[model samples]
Target: MLKELDLARREAEVSSLAQAEQDELAELREWLAAPEGAKDEHRRIAGLRAEVKEWQETYKKEKASWMRAICELTKQRDLQVSRADLFAKQLGQWRDIFQETDLTNLEQEWDPESSFYANEDAERRECQP
Candidate 1:
C-alpha cells in the first residue's frame, strides 16, 4: 500500500507539471496572436515610430517650402536693389545736364541728340509693355 501511494503521488506530480507546461504554451500562442492588438510596449513603440516618421516627412516638405520662399524673396530684393542703382545713375546724369543748362535763358538752344536726351528714344523702347 505504501508503494502504491508513492507511485500515485509521482503520477500526480507528473500530470501537474505537464498541465503547467501546456498552460504556458497556450498563453504564448495567445500572446503571439495578439501582440499588436494589445496596448503593450511593442504597440506603443510602433505607434511612436510611425508618428515620428510622419513628422519627419512633414518637416522636410515645410523646410523645402521655406527655403524656396527665402530664395524668391532674395531674388526680388536683388532685382529691386539693381533697379534702384540704375535709376540713381540715370538721375545723376539728368542732374548734371540740368546744371549745365540755364532754363531761364530764352535764347538757349536745346539739342535733342545731345546729352541725356540722346538716349531717351532707346531707353523708351527698352521699357517693357
Candidate 2:
C-alpha cells in the first residue's frame, strides 16, 4: 500500500510540472505573435533625431556665417561714412581759408592809378594831329 501511494504522488508531481512548462511555452508564443513595433519604433525615432541634429547644426553654421558677413559689412559702411565726413570737413576748412585770403580786396589794393593809359596815352598825345 505504501509503495503504491508513493508512486502515485510522484506521477502527479511530474504531471503538474509538465503542465506548468506547457503554460509557460504558450505564454511565450503569444507574446512573440503580438504586433509590437517597439524595436522598429526605436530605430525610426533615432534616425529622425539624427536628422534633426544635423539640420540644427547646419542652421547654426549658416547663422554664424551670416552674422559675420553682417558685421564686416557694417564695419565697411562705418568706415565709408567716416571717410566722407572727413572729406567734408577738409572741404569746409579749405573754404574758410579761401574766404580769409580775400582776393577781391587784394586786387583792389594793388590797382594802378590810370592803369590802362600810362605809355599808350603818352604816345597818342605825342602823335596827335
Writing each residue's lDDT as its tens digit, candidate 1 over 1-129 gives 547856986797689669868865775666577746563864565568569768966986797688679879999999999999999999999999999987786446666677586688778878957
Q: Candidate 2, which segments miss by more than 4 Å at Cα?
A: 1-36, 105-129
At residue 117, candidate 2 shows an lDDT of 67
Give the TM-score of each candidate. 0.51, 0.52
lDDT of 2: 0.76
Question: What value does the lDDT take at residue 49 in candidate 2?
Answer: 58
